[model samples]
Target: MQQYAILTYHQIDLAPPPPAQFRSLYVAPSAFARQMACLKALGYRGVSMRELLPYLRGDRVGKVVGLTFDDGYCNNLERALPVLQKCGFTATCYVMSHLLGKTNVWDIENGVTQAALMSAAQIRQWAQAGMEIGAHTQTHCKLPLMADADAMREISDCKAELGALLGEPVEHFCYPYGLYEARHAAMAQAAGYQSATTTQRGKVVVGTDFFQLRRIPVVRSTFMPQFLLKLLTGYENGKGA
Candidate 1:
């Protein structure tokens, strides 16, 4: 069986998080680097979602894993890139299109840290460094409550905007808050995205949904033992999600 773990991440730094949110959203840079090193040591090559498509399609599969970052925080390029480059891997960052060069106001309103997102130039630079840029909507809004046209614009328009910014086709997406319904997938498909990722936790196997793909979350609290469990069994604490 062809299997892969699509690992998802957010801000990756050792800086203390703001007083409001769970620490799980902040995976330490050392831990992030260690995770990548572990994957490589185990003979797994971390790949971008775009690069993992063929393996997902039942072609030949090696020990491959997919790495992704959500919200496109500046630290992704500033901190995660070097670790990834050291690991001989490439990954994708899902950018909130309209929020480039701005702080994460959405998370702030929800009492999370007011972290800075990547500027347009930083995004371009990351892409130039061989990382893939995926769309994460214009405002990082959830899709299920949105009307058809609104959802289409969030999904489709964001893709177009990022493609223009990166000077390449943006063909992957991620639903905000990992919340979605079937209609959202249709919107993503109509937007010309080859695939979309979700927060649903599991190891990806053959026949996984291209649109509603599950991801293994690497977070601050995922220490070595728990991380090993997730990699070995596709679940954390055996919850499977």
Candidate 2:
């Protein structure tokens, strides 16, 4: 039986930033490089969401994994891209349509500094470099708290805009802040996404819900020992602590 893992990341920076939450989620550039290296060394192949669908249907692949980065931080392009490419890995990057070339306000009210997202051009660069780009909604708003119309608009608009930019169908989505519900999943499906990811920690299996796929969040403290455990043991029992 084939099993799959969805790995998630945010900013890649060295040293802890002022915002404690930032440090908890951010994986430094060097550390990311090491992580990818470890995966490659362990014979893991990074597959895209689209590719994994076939595998989920019992089509076999050798040691397959999926990599996803949420929030579309410029650091993903500046730092993580190189490491991924070095390891011959391709990942899904979910970008907030409204935040392209703009600063994210998610952390502003909390007195924590936010990061700028990649521009449309940078997103195109990643596409050209063989990375799959997915929609992270128009404003990175939490979908579960949104009304039905608002949720529909957010998912539909982002997919339309991204498809126009990429000249390809944008079929994947990630719920902002890892927050999603049954309604959000239904909206994503109606909006034309083939699959969507959530922060709910777990390993993806043949019976997993395509629209509510779970991912393991990789953070600053996610070093070699924990990383190895995550891969070897899976995320069935992880609550992200």
Candidate 3:
């Protein structure tokens, strides 16, 4: 089988000092640059979900890695974009339709450090710069906990809302907090999404489920060797549910 590693990232800026929750989610800008450079050096093209679709569908094959940023952060634009452009790569940033220009308020209950999400203009710039913008929902809510009707609306309406913003079809979707159920997968498919990625730890292959496609996360603590292992080998496969 042809396997591809879809690497997940969040913030791409300096990590806040200790005691700030979810520090693992931040990847220092310098480190991110190095990682992208390493991929380029290794002859791998870091691509967006849109570009990786053919490979995932067995239509084409090459050394490509799906680069994705979850919960669209302003730093992703400020810090990650230049590095990606320098590397001649494209990535996907999944933004919450209703939360643009706002902080991650849904994480307040968990005491997670609030970070500014990309504003509407910044999102447009991201798209203008050849990056893909995927939908993360209207609000960053856990789909499995919501009523079915509400969950469906979150799934479908986000695609519509973001499509309107980008003036093109938003073909990708991602579950909030990586918390979803089988029904949510069905909902994503019904929402007209080409694919939906999850927090599941594994590499995707040609036969992998499109809606529940697995991903490998890159975090603050992921050093280069480990990152390469996750990206180039089966180190992360079968590790998460």
Model 2 RMSD, rounded to 1 decimal: 1.7
Give the winner by lDDT: 2 or 3.
3
Encode model 3's per-residue lDDT on 105-214: one tens digit a residue.
99898888999999888999999999999999999988988999999999899899889988999999999888999999999998899999999999998978999999
Q: What is the per-residue lDDT of model 1 for residues 37-85, given as tens digits with 9 covering 90 to 100?
A: 8888989888898889998988767788899999999999999999988
lDDT of 2 at 213: 85
Candidate 3 ranges with C-alpha deviation above 4 Å = none
The lDDT values for all models are 0.87, 0.84, 0.94
Which rank order by TM-score, best down to worst?
3, 1, 2
Worst 10 residues of 1 by lDDT: 232-241
Across 101-179, the per-residue lDDT of candidate 2 in tens digits comes to 9876877776656677899999999888899999999998978888889988999999999999889999999988878
Clashing residue pairs, backbone N/CA/C < 3 A, model 2: none
Q: Return the candidate ranking by lDDT, descending.
A: 3, 1, 2
TM-scores for all candidates: the values are: 0.95, 0.94, 0.99
* Best-performing candidate as measured by TM-score: 3
Give the candidate number with the greatest lDDT: 3
Q: Alpha-carbon error at 26 in model 1, in Å?
A: 0.3
Worst 10 residues of 2 by lDDT: 14-23
